[model samples]
Target chain A: MKYGIAYFPSKQIQDEVNSYRKRYDSHYALIPPHLTLKESFTADDAEIESLIPELKKIANETDPFNITINKVSSFAPISNTIYLKINPSPELQTLFDKLHSGKFSDDADHPFVPHITLAQDLVDQEYSDVFGSLKMKKYDLGDEVDRFQLLYQLDNGSWTVYETFVFGKEFV
Target chain B: MKYGIAYFPSKQIQDEVNSYRKRYDSHYALIPPHLTLKESFTADDAEIESLIPELKKIANETDPFNITINKVSSFAPISNTIYLKINPSPELQTLFDKLHSGKFSDDADHPFVPHITLAQDLVDQEYSDVFGSLKMKKYDLGDEVDRFQLLYQLDNGSWTVYETFVFGKEFV
Candidate 1:
């Protein structure tokens, strides 16, 4: 089975973001609006099951934080993927490092960049159509990520929720 | 603020189980029925924020699994806590082990054992009253755990949901 991990935005915000995605994101209906943490990887049932306790422990040890979307960007040459640019934070880098350290490493062929994907699998013209329309717009938005979910694609090619883990505590 | 992580039964089951708690458990109204993954711990806002990403990654790595409860059990001497006994499963043990490692280690002084809390902080008579009644009843029930949440203790001393995380994926 193929599985992935990500931080999903709140339902209300996601619904709004997805409205834009319907125009550009092919997987919009297949997956919710989220920032990829660990891209999809193949794992057997036993191997995946074995990782739970450790994941829960890791979750309990970490804390909730915020991310800001500053602008629209993309990987133009390598992959015609357009996304929201996140203003960098040390905490986010630490989190990415921590998650990719041991058993839960990144498996995506592309370099990992923290982004909220607006569109993917596009041709140059398609990318330009959306990027051109969005490039000049300012995106000063943010969200507090307190929890994240694990997702998997079924035989029918639909993404399904497999599990969710909340951050360790409520800091506010 | 104090915080905890637990697996709560479905609403229907929780409602029925809570009725029993109302008669026996003093904290019935204060909290719902749950199997705690992490006991309450104290941490600052920044520390708690740093844990969210790791927690989400952990949740994603772990797959959903089933748990069964066949009988009632307790820690009678050290504490007057009565709980539903969970059948032994390597998955559960692994989950516990994973959750207790490193920075997010279990802070509670009590030994960690997997059981759903039915009643706790009881006086001698209260303990005997409920324990004797419950011990005789066989509880042949099970549930699939696909998600868990972080809980916080409000200033009013009531527990509230801080955030919820679901299991990674379902492969059929």
Candidate 2:
């Protein structure tokens, strides 16, 4: 029911670093959409609240998070899960895997899919046109991610950062 | 927020499939924990109800899905994404990539780490003492997957299989 803050990428401060390039230059790899690895699940208020401290602990311990948001990705199979992928830097993805791989149920058979889902709704609407035109552009996640924020769904269903942790126990 | 369904394998299933002595052994990937991709996505009860018919239509139009689960793969920096290294037969990954690409978002830089997340919550946790001890084993994704089920979540935090469709038409 509870979600962790470690999975979030929106925590990075917005600037030239996190902002996507509207103009297409070059250097763009063939980017793909964020793929969903599971079915949809729900979290209760209590569940969200329960994760705050734990999330804080990990964010504190995991230091020097280097990040770069390459491009957003999505998945819309005919009748399957869909999501927005937040492409983290390879180093950051490795750190995340080291932190996460054993904690959940599916440890042995699969690995992580570095993404931050911008899922605000239940339906997977077809956006053939949007996907058709969007071009991949370079975007920096951050030179160095000093902190990570915990995002929780507000009563109105808007996501607000619930807590934050700075690496090295400064905020812990 | 509403979420969608994708299959990420759990540790429970991985341990089972890895013990096979020969490639001829029939194996199956464990269903990973379903994730809630959307944060504040909408789907009214009525809307969900009416959408099932449309969903059924989409299912009917979708290509047949056949997949195979294969060797263990991990991500670096972090296991946020898992690579299904050595790949598998059935060409499921290709199908998953093609049918769902760009449906969730327009910008994604990371490749689909093919493994399911071992843990749902990535936190301050210990890594496995005997991790990869069973890498000597192999598994299968099962012989046939006629179709995936359609499911939805209620406001009260419960889930239901809304409808079912087949590889081409009818259900398994």
Candidate 3:
């Protein structure tokens, strides 16, 4: 069977107020659209399902929060993995910590590090050589945080979004 | 099945090495250490078999080329597509041209925008923000072109090298 992500989830935060989208009937649990990345893996779906209860529990006692996607980083400090890093505000951190520590209900839960994976293991001399020579330049604009999505794997081994929810903000 | 890559036959040239590795007593055509990335996905055995001949043909006659992974790049340019862009080298451009123009065996083809994907796709923001902020600081580190590989898909669907073949420096 193809894997899937269920329920609402958060990965990054948005900057603009309008970016937030909601899940459930409550307007408080919203997601930032700008932070929403594309598609997801089966592994992601499973993990999110396992974390719902704990996340709700935290949100109950905690004040609403905001998250910000801050910088980009490299895995080997040079080679291999590369991705974007998120920095949630303090209130967001409390929720993140609760979710991360007991994030997934799975028996084999993944340790949450709060970063979005841009690419994983890419190594081939011909491929890497071409990759290695690249000189990436950066440009940031007035961007905002959006909602996070729950992703799933389809029968064709493709990933799709199961759902999206906002945090700390209400949507139109 | 476990996804993997195999380098086979010989690296002297693509067409010249095509049938060598599968010849009994040619175990040398394999990648022993099984180069792996930290967050790699696994694929089933049978699924990966299909891509072999295709990768082999690519290794052969692909030509001696230099490419510029000149900088760290994100897909969608403004957004993330979970891949890095490589500046196709002139020699490699010759290959891309040949492939795009149907110069290679007409059946063996692809629109050649030579690039090695850094990550499969940005699903979870595990590191998207961090990776996004990274600007590939350009620097040249001369390394020899060794061999190319034929990768396989594991049950989990991540790719690994199943076979490989080396190229002689005099291949040109």
Q: Name the best candidate (by lDDT).
A: 1
Per-prediction TM-score: 0.51, 0.32, 0.29
Interface RMSD of 3: 20.7
lDDT by residue for model 2 (A1-172), tens: 3233433222222212112211221101111111222222245657645544554556556777554555645545532222234554665664555444443223323455655333222333324333333325434443465555443322222222233345554322
What lDDT score is found at residue A155 in candidate 1?
42
TM score of chain A per candidate: 0.89, 0.50, 0.45
Candidate 3 per-residue lDDT, tens place, B1-172, comes to 3333322211122221122212211221222211121122244445444443444455455554443334544545444433334455565554334432332233322344443333333444733663555444552322223344444332222232323333321111
Worst 10 residues of 2 chain B by lDDT: B21-30
In the range B108-166, model 2's lDDT, one tens digit per residue, is 24544444333312222322321243344465543343444443433333332223333
Query: lDDT of model 1 at residue B153?
Result: 62
Maximum-TM-score candidate: 1
Docking class of 3: incorrect
* CAPRI classification of candidate 2: incorrect
Model 3 chain B: ten consecutive residues of lowest lDDT: B24-33
Worst 10 residues of 2 chain A by lDDT: A25-34
Q: State, as a TM-score between 0 and 1, how close model 2 is to the true structure.
A: 0.32
Q: At residue A14, give the lDDT of candidate 2.
A: 20
DockQ of each: 0.04, 0.01, 0.01
